[model samples]
Target: MARNFIRETLAKENETFLRRMEIPNKDSWSPENGPTSVRRHPFCSSLKMFLVALSFAYFSKALSGSYMKSTITQLERRFDIPSYLIGVIDGSFEIGNLLVIAFVSYFGAKLHRPKIIALGCLLMSLGTFLIALPHFIIGRYKFETSVRSSANSTNNLTLCPTSVLVGNHSSTLSSTGCENESRLSMWIYVLLGNILRGIGETPVQPLGISYIDDHALEDNAAFYIGCVQTISVIGPVFGYLLGSLCAKIYVDIGFVNMESISITPGDARWVGAWWLGYLIAGLITLISAVPFWFFPKSLPVPEGRLAKCSPERTSFIKDSPGLDHKYQADEQFSFVRLAKEFLPTLRSLLGNPVYVLYLCVTVIQFNSLIGMVTYKPKYIEQHYGQSASKANFLMGVINIPAVALGMFSGGVLMKKLKLSIMGAAKFALGTSLLGYFLSLFFFAMGCENAKVAGITVSYEGMESLSHQNSTLFVKCNAHCECSKTEWDPVCGENGLTYVSPCLAGCRMSRGSGVDTVFEQCNCVAGGNLTAYVGHCRHRESCQRVFPYFLALCVITSFIISLGGTPGYMLLIRCIRPQLKSLALGFHTLTTRTLAGIPAPIYFGAIIDTACLKWGHKKCGGKGACRIYNTTAYRIAYLGLTLGLRTASFFLCALGLVVLQRHIKRQENGTLSNGNTGHTVAELQALRKEETHNSHSDQSPRTSDYDPERETRL
Candidate 1:
């Protein structure tokens, strides 16, 4: 009976609060009184239309990000660069975001949001197209090979000196300056393109979310966002699938005689059609941009819902002179005004201890997340001995889908439970800890290192090789005319890996290119003195472990992503409603700068240290690291990730305690001031109005906690 009385009292309080906060329909909202556009199309005002455009925007950006992850190794091989260089390229996007995100997040509210978003999308499309430009302009992709054949594989005629002995077409050999090339850093285009993409993506999240929150039903906001996220998740799946398809095709398939290529997709030095996925993704991005151009600055709010905020007063703002610097709705755009007030507002926000604690957790979590994601596919390929094509396919079809489902499920749980700020924080904390715990098993799930001559195993297979033993000189190949730096791997029939025929002490080689085989290979054991072209296949033990690894990945992805939505919503609830945009923008800016930008570079650099065999560049500098010490790679990759996240959890626990205290103080302050009502800003007021709905919908349960007793505002 006491519980029932308390519930009734809070219900009455909430009902009274909602009635006072409600806006007058005639005075606050109407298309007739709003800012008139050049073309006031009805579709621009439709919430459904804007939602569609926003969803597409989300899809396009995610597709590009995930696709880049899938193609990291391919890009490394194609550019003849090391892992660290690719990490730099990955970090370039964050650099672009850091440049324009603050201004866009703050000032963009004063402008046409949809049109600005459309412009950003166009920039992304152009950037995506630009990333593929190197492939077209770089001439034919000449993968490094050391072979000599008399006839072509595709033409049965000598096409080039390196052609295989089975072809249908023949072209005379033509040598270019490629052999003596020096300025091999053609990856600059991909970097700039990624930077443009980052700049384009900057406005989408803050602006788009703010816009939706402005006009959508307060109760449905989280659910709607969840739906959009679920749709957006589809992009990565397609991206990975697209990446997989492209990786199977040879880099210069149609342009060159593919039959004469000595390496398979399984070969460490192989470069796939990594550029093609970008072109297709860009085209999709261009299409996504089209719908946004037609959307208006603001849409008319539905009945019972509060009207949208005026453009002059942004949803996110910087307060100067005082904690509350109120702006008139008719104030003009002024750089002088914003410049004067920016720092004080920033300082005031940073002063919130709870927000600071949350920031610590986010920055640390993102560091781990970014580092793992940036090198995850490479980790799979190098550790599991999977091909690039297979790794991408698995990531796309299995891992990403799990994440998508988890994200959607998280949002649904929030809406269904109507979790308060405290509730959301607890839920996020639990899921994260659980996921981290489960991920601990990945360290144990390791594949044995590939057997490479002079690297992991001896050339004659008589003894094991150590890290100190790098030179491929044995009793059999000691007198062979071979350069230590020359690395064109060949698979010997004696189940041993050889550096090359020259290093294998082979006097003569039969056929050329793809059809090439070295006979009388002195390095091979007595039974069969023959060696085929390209790297040897992985052992059966490695292949058997792949299925279990993939299953674990799917489960881990789902559990980790389950926390994503709750964590996001918790962030929204923790900040002042008016400063939502600024808080989100600041969070993204700091996280991207501190974590996203540096994570990949450092992760790749560490992984680079584990390289057992480094591919050669055209000008003879260190190219891509072809083989990695699997044990070392695993330790570097997972250790850093797990360590960062584990440390972040301490912050998460602290943040939870801090949040509880903040809520208590905030409630006390509200009670002391007797401020039972929200201000007359439509969007902000509606959030308060929904407080009654959020509480009353809850079922009475015997518990240690009671939200009704604490909600003073």
Candidate 2:
């Protein structure tokens, strides 16, 4: 009886092991074997469905982020703050991103990622709405002016040329007398709202990309990433366009007459309808969240797809379906285990010299990108003398679309050529070098600076400038009661921008608001007396350079972005496959922490040093800059951008060399097997399986990083 019982126990134990281990269907799957049935998960998505959902989510988040980027200048004008202050506000988003990204990227894999992502989307939408909240809460905007158009009309009437003038106006200077008014400083609301927006944006990329990487077919991964990136980049096109449209709308909108606004969008003092874009972006983000909450935490493996790992090693591969058990089974999470693994995993990643170098290259590159983008619009307005509206329109219509095309083409090239990791690195390096070479030409495309009296040119309008820094007062207008801090600019017919009607020695003026024409301006040269209420537009030479600059911008953007996909793939494939989410997270965290938060601030500070004229706050102290020394501004902005890019090229070269050597070593050891040369051990098994299955009914698609699909050298 005892012998029989022991034999029965041994038989039951064998049955259990066979059930758990995916005992290979020798008849169904072997090198010489015939076609066999394969199991698929019920909850798995079709490629089409995954693309649609992923694209929409990326578009929504990018739209909101880009909108904020487009409106920085507007915010500075509206809040009466310096460029550096606005930079701090812009960097708030990076702060929020830094706080939660590491934890979320590390822990999200074990949780219900879809729900977490939905929650993040909801927060982002809420934050956007809150950013717009200040517009409604604050009182009607009360701009300071040298001409009080509301109550003093008689002085203006006396100096009027009835032929050019129509409305009753005023010339008596007025101040809002906002003495020490701390209670109504609503800029704080805007700052907090932006911070909230930053927090909300944390999960969109790290979680979303990881989710796609986890479930999408290995062959389609890079292309899908490119598609998602393309859509996200395209989102900024509409964002800049939206910024352009809203800038034309008066900041007060329905509350004030458009005709009554003394400043046009081209005016330095002008504040665009910044809040409107935020509102629209918020609504879109809200809509983006709805699809995520319903998406399953994980998808089932697709049918007839060859598992990368063997059936016997199913337990070793979390993502592979080597066994028949449902994906939902064996669900578990432990914070203790997460804590235990964190340091060891982190150490392992840092030990990889290739990843560290890639991280440095990306960080430097991002710093240049963020700083350049942050200041590009301002540079255009100050250097090219384009309006904020025109600058945004050019960015939207030209620059962003070029980036989308470049990104998509990169993906297509990778797919068509089936580039190995070494090949992709080489491609990325070549494009980066070419792009850097093209960008240096921008230094030659400089436009003549604005001909402002006492700054770029002498008040007497001499071509020879004695000093960059000059006093606002000259003999002709020195006796007039002028405030050096005031920024109520007027354009004389002689093509000089006056500080104000007061500084112009115009004791009288005609018309109201933008129509307010200062007549008999005492400071005019060549006896030209009339001046309009706006800065003199830049010289005609500037108009010709504008198109050339746009062309260069388009070409440069395309070439640089062409390398974006290949570079991203290099970052992914260098690390162990299991740490993809963590690798991505750490990279984001490191870049954002070291680069994103500081780049804008330092750029703004350097730009601030080039300020020629500054506006004043009614309460006290310096506010926004009225004018910049275009020469200094151009040199500082473009020089910094190009220098960073040049430095990145060196790093890129070194990284490529390191990667090539590493691959060569792996190849010598017979470890590297994939077309992309990923050194994972499972590649050989999968490759062996695929080679023998060529005679089967269905075959897998050829892609970049696998052995069965060798790349064309």
Candidate 3:
């Protein structure tokens, strides 16, 4: 009763507040008058569209990167699979993604974006469910013995120098051998699941961009795109945090100590509880799809026009004064057109030496950033001898701040320097590469010392005390030394032997020093010390690398964000009003398709190979393994850094050259591709008209078509 009364009172207060604010109730509103009258409601239709886009973005972010990391790590630990094979699995996600993107870009324009998004969401959920099923089966039976025996056999059965496990074990094992069955079956399922997810998620990228392009004005496109990308960053951050939290919870719950039915007392549990997190993520993804049913059916396409009035005046003229106009509506929204269109754009983009250079630089920068992000945690665990949870936490702690600062700085530099989109991208890429190098240096040093310090400090105090006590007695009491010969020290000593006391004291002091030095040196020499320090140092490096890496990621994102801005401005300042949407759409389709397809596979391959080599450190000869592991990681980092730097330089050069050309063309009062001055001026006039018409409720009539559109289309 009390709870109900409180709720009733709060509801009444809320109603009173709304009344005071003159908030219009949605039920009493009409759509024809627009959303202004019911300002409190905003545009439900647009809001729904935005939310749908957000959901897809979130899932894509989670599934593409963070999920890959989690799944690969799980596979490496549970199945003892080689890192190279794991790389293949990781790369497969991208392969699947690329193929799907191609197909979607061809067919998606005909399909409703909402339905496409929904389908993708469903498929992702299914994939996650299938991938996780085998674990459940294995967990249920508690089959400790069979798994242990098979693992032992596999360890004994080395097939090649690569340590690849490639036998048909299913034939030899009984149905009840759940451990082996689960291990083998789960991987197969996971691979299949990832492939399905890749295909499902493909349509999401293009469709999402289309949706944003459809609703947002051309001038604001880039800003909105940036907002989307910013949201994307959240997915990984959340995934990493959740994954780490789950791991900690598992450890705290003593899940790590539960022995397999057949293993030794200290054996780890076969089925980890951390998997629950994956299941939960899938469920959340599914739930996110619910709002798609309510998305608006269509949006008003934007039109271009020009005003005869001055900049401050609102009155407009229908056509440019004293100019023959030629313009037409060119819809490039069809899926078939997008697919067919991409090849030409891709060719053109590739042919542009500047663009090609930028692409290469971007790829390399992304590779290094991704490689470090994916493996830093594992590196910390292996090198610094830290737990997975602690390593991950340390990674988060270091990266969050570094990335935040890098992102802020990148934004500031772009704004202050008045960089064009490409210039900004180059600056971001270069800065990120520098960060990667600095992180690598710190990581290497930290790893070396962390191991040396942790172990030596732990053992040094006890050893030092032992030496001190031995030395103190030798210096203070001569009778104590005489007791060694006669048992009775005071009565049977025949007086204290002071003759050799000085020598004994000197020897003890020298011995103590030698012992301390030996212990310190010995601890440092063992590569295990590397493991402890490596974890923290690697984490710190990753954190340091985050901003630059984030900046690099956002560079492409920023380009995508600014998608409609250039074309819209070109239309308003120079192009036919009727061609605005069509031109903007064409540009958007070109850039997004080109950028999105290769990212998944390219990054996946780098991460996979790095992981494989990192895992191999566990198998090599004892003395050589740590060195091999450390060297392998160093090589990986070097590859990433060099690749990024090369890319950065290229992008910077290309952007500078292109912008210079664009500016020169503007100054000459001539159009590229040799259009006439009259035609160009008329086009610019139409764009001004379209911008004015867009802000008002007036609809554009079909009779406004001009001849220039025919030639362009």
Q: Model 2: per-residue lDDT, tens digit, 218-277?
A: 777767886887788778888899988988887899988666678878888788888999
lDDT of candidate 3 vs native? 0.43
lDDT of 3 by residue, 147-190 (tens): 22222222222211121122224223423353343224346666
TM-score of model number 1: 0.80
Which regions of candidate 2 fall more than 4 Å away from where they truly are? 1-53, 148-176, 209-227, 295-338, 463-469, 526-528, 671-713
Per-residue lDDT, model 2, residue 220, is 75
Please say which candidate is ahead in lDDT: 2 or 3.
2
* Residue 528 displacement (Å), model 2: 6.6
lDDT of each: 0.75, 0.74, 0.43
List TM-score per model, in order.
0.80, 0.80, 0.56
- TM-score between candidate 2 and the true structure: 0.80
